[model samples]
Each structure stands twice: as C-alpha cells, then as structure tokens.
Target chain A: MDSIDKKLLNIMQKDFPLSSTPYKDLGEMLGISEEDVINRLGKYKKEGLIRKIGGIFNPRSLGYKSTLVALEVKEGKLEDTASFINRYQEVTHNYQRDHTFNLWFTLIAPSRERIKEIIDSVERLPGVRKCMNLPSVKMFKIGAYFSLDEEGEREEQKSDQ
Target chain B: MISDRDKKIIKHLQEDLPLDSRPFKNIAEKVGMEERELLKRIEEMKEEGMLRRLGAVVHHYQAGFAYNAMGCWRVPQEMIDEAGKKMSCYREVSHVYQRPSHPPHWPYNLFTMIHGHSREDCEGIAESMAEETGISEYTLIYSLREFKKTSMKYF
Candidate 1:
C-alpha cells in the first residue's frame, strides 16, 4: 500500500465521515476526487485488502454476550470437534492453534445465560476433554487497525490506484 | 433501543453500501427518506453509540499483517488491571480483555491479540509483553486457519 492508501486506511477504519457525500468528504481530506476515493476503495475490496466498508455496531450496547473459548480435544478428533463446534451460529471465530489445549473459538450470543448453555453443550461433545470460557470482563481495545507508515512489505499485486 | 427507521438504515449499512458516487442517495431511496435526512440519521446513530463508524474493515492478512497471535496472560487477580492497561498501550496488542481463568486446566485471565508482519515479530512482542507484565504463565496461540470471520448482522 502506498502512503496515501495508508492514510486512507488509518482514517477510514477509525472514523469515517457521516455525510451525504461521504466519499467526497474523504476525498477532501486526502486531496483526491470523490470518484478516486470510491474507485480505490472498490479495488481494495476486490483485492481483499479492505474486507468491507460499513457500519460496525456495538454488540454490548445491542445486548449480546461474547467470550473466547479454549478446548482440549483428543488428537484424533481435532477435525471432527472443530467442525462440530462450527455448526453453532453463535461461534463466530474458530481456529486450530499449536498448543496442548488446541481448539479455540469466540462465541457470541444474545444473552450470557445462552452463552453458558452453549458452553455446556460443547462440553458434552465426545473427545472434548475440557472447555475454558473466557468472557471479557474488561475491554482495552476493540479491533485491529494496521498503521500505513510501515514500509518494505513483500510486493503483492497492487490494487488499482 | 432502535426504532424501525434505525433498523432499516442498519440493514442497509450492514451490507455493502451501494457502489456509486453518491451511496447515501441510494440508501435514501431504499429507506424512503431524503438524502439529507438519511445522513443526519446516521450521524445521530453514531452520536447515540448505535453505529460505531462508517469505514473499511481491513483484512490484516491482505494488508501485510500476516502474523497474528493471541496472548492469554495469567496475571494475578490484583494485577489484572495493571497488566491489561499496560498491554493495551502497545500498538501490536489489539482486543485486550480481562477474562476469568479456571485454574488446573486454563490459567489465563487477560487476553490480547497481537499482530506482526512475521511470526518472529509476533513472538518478540509477546516476549516483551511477558517481561513487561512480570507474568510468565501465558500462551501465544497463533491462528492456523480462519474457519469463519464476519461482522454480526443483528439488524
């Protein structure tokens, strides 16, 4: 990503403008045309650099309970266990990690009681030896944002300028 | 806490905004409101803390932050706030949270997602965090595969 692109990513991710012509506002800040900003964002989306451009709601404010869960599964049941855990809509993120208690995922539900119920059901699944539900009591940072200033990255095919 | 109009705007915002120069114009048309009123409503939602922001969600993998690891720390109960506050200051550390850890099986109370351009970079930050916090009991679990990732569509 170029310097300008970095600046765009930085501002766009943190706080985008709320206006009738939002891209025009972004263009004004970046010293570009409205069409240019839109086109660049479109290209970034196509390249998977920009995942999505939209509103991010506060789940806690919307009455949702979320927690990070870790599971120690038998070696042979890794795939089966992970897939079984994935079937639940509440399970948003699931991953295999390099640890003894390998399988981990994040579960979000409408209520804390539902989260506990889901965890209880997960504990009953065969090959699941243990379940650790780490619910967030305090939040320091909400999401990930990479600074654009960093240079010298492996050149992937560039998105349209 | 949201009205029907708020719900309608959310449904539009959750999906991709219309790919046009004046995206709000299309949203206004779909939501049955004036373009100017649509903009004002969005501003109000943000002020009311319903909508966080209108922006691009970068895929770290595609954005050169290829290496990412979760640092679950086992800080003492009393030191939880201090460690969490300190770790949150680090730029690499994202999404720091205080969670209850069941001992004898899991002993991590504070968790942070750390990202880097490389695995070594991630590990280095994790080590520095451990040293800074003075809590050696922790695990840096790097994500091996992304089974699913998406924003919640509550609207």
Candidate 2:
C-alpha cells in the first residue's frame, strides 16, 4: 500500500462514516472519484489489510452485559471445550492461551442473568474443569487505531488532539 | 467541523446504507434532510476525524484467510511502548495493545494479533515475533471458532 492507502486505512479503522455516498465524499477529499475509493477499499479487503469496515459501537451502549471469561480445561479437550463455548452467539472472541487457565473469551448477553445462565451452561461441558469471569473495572479504551505513518510521539499527538 | 446534525446523519447511516442507485437521495428522504445537507455533514465529519469512508465488512473465514491467532508477549512494564511500537511495524501484526497482566492468573502483558491463511502461517508470525522480542516465554492463542462478529450498536 502507498502513503495514501495507509492514510486511508488509519482513518477508516477508527470511525467509518455511516453514509450512503461515503466513498464519493471521501473521494472528493482525496482528489479521487468515488469509483476509485471503492476499488481501492475492495483491493484492501482482498489483501487482508482490514478485518472489517462496518459499525463499531460500544457494547455497553447497546445494553449488553459483557465480560471476559477465562477457563482451564483438561488435556486433549481444548478443541471440544473451545468449540462448545464458542457455539453461543454471546461469545465474541475465543482463544486458547498457554497458561494454566488456557481458554479465554469475551461473552456479551442481554442481561446479567442471561450471562450467568450461559456461563453455567459452559461449565457443564465435559472436560471443563474451572471457569472465571473478569469484567473490565474501568475502560481506558483508545479505540484501536495505529497511525502507521506518524513516526513520533503518537500518544502525545493524541493527547494534543 | 462536525455539528449535532452531522452526528444525527451518521446515526442514520449506521442503520444501513441505501443499496440503490440514488442512495444519497434515499438517505436524505429517510432522514428528512436535503441531499446536499446530508452530504455536507458527511464531509465535515471526515475532516473532523469523526468518520472514515463507508465500505463493506467482510467475513475473513468466508474469504479463506482463516488462520487468526492472538499472540501475547510478556513485556516488562518499561518496555511496553517499545514492544508495542515494534509489533506495530510488522505488516502481519494487525492489532497491537497493552493490557494489564495479573500473574498466577493472567501472565501475558502485551497483545498482538495476526491473521493468515493457515495455522502454519500464524505460527510463522509467532516464531518471528519470539525471535524479534528475544522473549522465550509467550503465548499464541488461536481462535478455534468465531461465534460473533457483529459490531455493537451506538444508539
């Protein structure tokens, strides 16, 4: 990707405009046409440079009670336990770590009772030995944007902004 | 450059972008605003760092780049910025961040993510990262399956 592409990516990752002619408006700013913007974005997606380009909202804002859950399963059942936990739509991301409590995932439910219900269901799965949930006490979230082009004092730049 | 009206325009846009030929006109009609007004608000948001371009959100596995793993490194508190900066440079590294590590419970300090076509591809990135950081003890947590990918709603 070129400098322009990198800039486009950096901007898009944080806040993608929700507009019908967003590309057309974006093209106007970049001195390109809407067709060019569409083509470039298509190419970027094809290249795996971006995971997704859609609405990214705060889960809490949507009234979902979410928490990060960690679990340790017996040997040889990692795959099975992980799949079982992931089968629920409430589980957003599930990963197998190297620690004793190997499996960790985030779960979001419409209510606290529903979350407990789901957690209980996950615990019932065979080979699941232990489970714990750690909800974020406080969020210092910066919304995950890497300014690849900006080479110096990025944190400072953000604070200044 | 963005005002309250611009924010409202985005709130409407998030529901769904019109899929027709005259999408802007369609959006304008729905939002009870003129096309020019809606277009102007979008332009301001872009300038103000509030909105990027609109586009399609792809399903990675559907497209066949399915090997995605979250690799965490145990960087000392002093080296987090250095490690995060280093990890951010790699093209393979998509997401990089620093999360609190509670040892005897949670040991990994720095988190970096890489998505590839296969497990071997992800392993390659992990091995390379190990060599780069000179940290022998780390974790490569691969996703066994994806349950949800929907973005949370703002409104």
Candidate 3:
C-alpha cells in the first residue's frame, strides 16, 4: 500500500468522521477526492484488510454481561467441543491457545443466567474436563487501533535519501 | 434508558456502515428519520459511553500485527490499579483487565494483550511492560489458532 493508503487506514481506525458526508470529510483530511477515498476503502474492504466500519457498543451499558471462559477439552473432542461452543451467538471470540486449558472464548449475553446456562451445557459436553469463567473485575483499556505509518515513514525516508 | 427508536438506530449502526458520501443519510432514511437527527443521537450515545467508537475494525494480521500474546501478570492486590494504568500506556497493549484467577492452575490477575509484528516483538513488549511495572511474575500465552472471531450481534 502507498503512504496515502497507510495514512487513510491510520485515521479511519481511530477518528472516522461522524457526519452526513463522511467520505468527503475524510477526503478533505487526506487531501484526496471523495471518490478516491470511497474507492480506496472499498478496495481495502474487498482485500480483507478492513473488516468493517461501524459502531462498537458497550455490552454492559446495554444490559449485557460478558466473560472470558477457558476450557480443557480432551484431545479427541477438541473440534466437536469448539463447534458446540461456537453455535451460540453470545460467543464472539474463540481461540485455541498453547496451554492445557486450550479452548478460550469470550461471551456476551443478555444476562448472567444466560452465561451460566451456556457454560453448564459446555461442561456437560463430552471431553470437556474443566471450565473457568473469568470475568473482568476492572477494565483498564480496550482499543485495537494498529498504526500503519511506521513502514510508510521508513519508505519516505529511504526515498528522500 | 434507551428508547425504542434508539434501539432501531443501534441495530443499523452496529452493522457495516455503507461507504458513501452520506452514509448516515442512507441509514436515517431506512429508520424514518432525518440525517441530522441520527447524527445527534449517535453523538449523544458516544458521550454517554454507550458507544465506544465508530470506526474501521481492521483484520489485525492483515494490518501487519501478525502476532499477539496475552500477558497475564501475578500482580499484588494493592498494586493492580497502578500497574494496570502503567500497562495501558503502551500502544502495543490493546487491552488490560483485572480478572479473577483460579489458584494452583491460573494465578494471574492482570491481563494485558500485546500485539506485534512477530513473536519476538510481542515478547519484547511484554518484557518492557514487566520492567516498567516492577512485576516480574508473568506468562505470555500465544494463540495457536483462531477458531472464531466476530463482533457481537447486539440489537
């Protein structure tokens, strides 16, 4: 990607315009035409670089409860157990980490009871040995903005030399 | 308290917003409201902390942050808050949380997720974080595979 593309990604990750004509707003900030901004974003989306441009809501504020769950599934039943857990809409992120308690996932549900119900069902599933529900006592930070300008800056410096 | 109309707005806003010059206008039309009113409500939600952010959610690996490790620290109860704040200052640390730790098996209370270009880079960030916080007892758990990762479908 070009430097302009890197800059656009960086800006959109944190401060996407919240206006009637957001593309135009972004275009002005990036010194590109509105059409160009739209095209580039569209291209990035198609290329799987940009997942989505939307609102990230606070689940707790919306009367929801979320928790991180770690489970130790028997080696033979890992695939089945993961698929069973993934069937719930409440389960958003599920990963197999390098630990005895390998299957780790996050769930956001409408109520604590719902969270319990899902966990209970998973524990009953064959090959599931142990489960731990780790809910956040305090959240210090939660932002996932990756700066894409470092490489772009290096390229600029190289060209200047 | 959120009104029914606000729920309708939230439902649409949570989806992938259109890449148009007037994207909100399109959403407003669908929700039977003017563009200006929709913008106002969105701004209010943001101020109220109901909406965390409205921006691009990139694929991290695709964005060049191909490696990430969850650094779990065994912080003393008294120093958790101070250490959490210090850890949050790192740009590489996207999330820092204090969670319940099960004894004998899992004894780490503070969790900071570090993302980097490679495994070594992630470890380096964790090391610096350990040095800064003065908490040496920690473990960096790397994800071996991502089974599923998606945003919550809130209505």
Candidate 4:
C-alpha cells in the first residue's frame, strides 16, 4: 500500500466518519475529493485489503454472554469441524492453534443455555475429541489501538461507551 | 443545528453503526430526518465523545496475523505503565492492560495478547519481549481456538 493508502487505513480503522457523506468529509481532511476516496476504498475492497466496512458492535451491551471455548478435534477433521462451527452467526472467530486443545473459537449466546447448546452442537460434529470452556471471569482490557506509525504509543482502550 | 430528528438519528447511530456509504442517509430514513440533519448530529456526537469510532473490525485470523496467546506478567505496581507501554507498542501485541495480581489466588499482574502467523512467530515475539523488557517471569497461554470475538454493547 502507498503512504496515502496506509494513512487512510489508519484513520478508517479507528474512527470512520458516521456522517451521510463520510467519504466527502474524509476526502476534505485528506485533501482529496470524495469521489477519489470512494474509488480508492473500492480498490482496497477489490484487492481484499479490507474485509468489510461496518460498525463493529459491542456484544456485551446487546445482552449476549460470551466465552472463549477451546477443544481438541480429531486430527484429520479439524477443518471440517471448523467449517461446521463457523456456520453460526454468533461464532465471531474460530481458529486452529498448536497445542493439546487445538481448536479455539469465541461464542456469544443470548444466555447460558444457548452457550451450552452451541458447545453441544460443535461436540456433535464429526471428528470429535475433547472440549473445555475458559470463560472470562474478568476482562482486563478489550479494544486496542493499532497505530501504524513506528513511534506510536499503545493505548489500553475501553471496549465501548 | 440540533433537532428532535437529529436526536433520533443519534439514537440509531449509537446502535449497529452500519458499514456502508451514505449510512447517515440510511439512518435518516429510519429516524425520519433529513440526511443533512443526521450528519450534523453525528459530527456533534463524535465531538462530544458519545461516539468513539465507526469502522471495520476485521477478522484477524483471515488477515494471517492469526497466532495468538494470552501472556501474563508479574508486573510490579510501579513499573506496569512502563512495561505495558513497551509491550503495547508492538503491532503483534493487541490488548495490553494491568490487572491486580493476587498471590495464592491469581498470579498474573499484567495481561497482554500477541498475534502472529505461526506458533514460532508468536513465541519469537514473546522471546524478544522477554529479552527487551528483561522480564523472565512470564507465561505464554496460547489460544487453542477462537471460540468467540465480538465487542460488548454499551446501553
């Protein structure tokens, strides 16, 4: 990415404009026209540099209880089971790691029962093994700022308003 | 330049905060207000700190910065800020904050997350951190799976 692209990414990652014409407003700040901003962002999207542009919700405020559950899937069926678990909209992130409990994902549910239900759903998936739930008893920190600038300081950000 | 319609706009914007062009226009239609009025309220809310940001919270795994671990440090009260500052500066380190370390109960005084493309990469970052900070007493709790990753809501 060019300097302008990096600068734009930095700005967009933190505080995207919520205005009706955010591109126009952002262009004004960046000393470019609104059309240019849109075209550049469109290119970024096409290049897969930007996965999606949208409001990231604070799940806790929306009344969903979440937890980080870890499990070991049958060695060969990891990918299949991962795809199965990823089907749920509530399954925000899923990944494979190098450890005894290899597969990890985050699950948010409307209630404790729903959390159990989802776990059972995954447990029933082919290539089953062992599972464990490590729910966050306390949250030390959540949102973090990634300032691309080399000299930027790290900020321990509050998750939401 | 505030109006009742603007308040409605602000109310909706505080929720979901769509990722789309002309989001304010979308919100304006929902809140029964003109797009310009909605825009003004958003600008004001951002200025007032009621709205922190509106942007893409990407799927970290897909980005290839996937390897992650919960690192714990027995940070002294006096040096947490110094240590946290050092750890948080690394792009690989995402969340760095202080938590009370209660002995005979909980031992980790400071917690931070490190992300990378592979286990070796994550450990390499951790090793460098240990060397740079001279922090020998640390444990790397690698995440075996990512069960969930979402933000909390503020009512």
Candidate number of the best DockQ: 3
Docking class of 4: acceptable
Cα lDDT tens digits, model 3, A57-161, are 999999889999999989989889899999999999999999888999999999999999999999899889898889999998887676666564211010000
**Candidate 3 chain A — worst ten consecutive residues by lDDT sum?**
A152-161
Model 1 lDDT per residue over B1-155, tens place: 66788789888987877657788889889999999999888888778777766778788787777888888888888898889888877877767888888987777888888877788988898899989989898888887767667777774
RMSD of 2: 7.4
The alpha-carbon lDDT assigned to residue B47 of candidate 4 equals 64
Give all TM-scores, in the order shown: 0.89, 0.59, 0.95, 0.68
lDDT score at residue B112, model 4, on the 0-100 scale: 76
- The DockQ value obtained for model 2 is 0.15
Span of ten consecutive residues with least summed lDDT in model 1 chain B: B146-155
lDDT at residue A71 of model 3 (Cα atoms): 94
- The Cα RMSD in angstroms, rounded to one decimal, for candidate 3 relative to the true structure is 4.3
Ranking by lDDT: 3, 1, 4, 2
Docking class of 3: medium
TM-score computed on alpha carbons, candidate 4: 0.68
Superposed model 3: Cα runs more than 4 Å off: A153-161
Question: Ten consecutive residues with minimal summed lDDT in candidate 4 chain B?
Answer: B146-155
RMSD of 1: 4.3
Q: Tell me, per candidate, how large a share of the native contacts it keeps.
A: 0.77, 0.17, 0.87, 0.38
Candidates' interface RMSDs, in order?
5.0, 6.8, 5.0, 5.8
**Each candidate: RMSD:** 4.3, 7.4, 4.3, 6.4
Model 2 TM-score on a 0 to 1 scale: 0.59
Worst 10 residues of 2 chain A by lDDT: A152-161
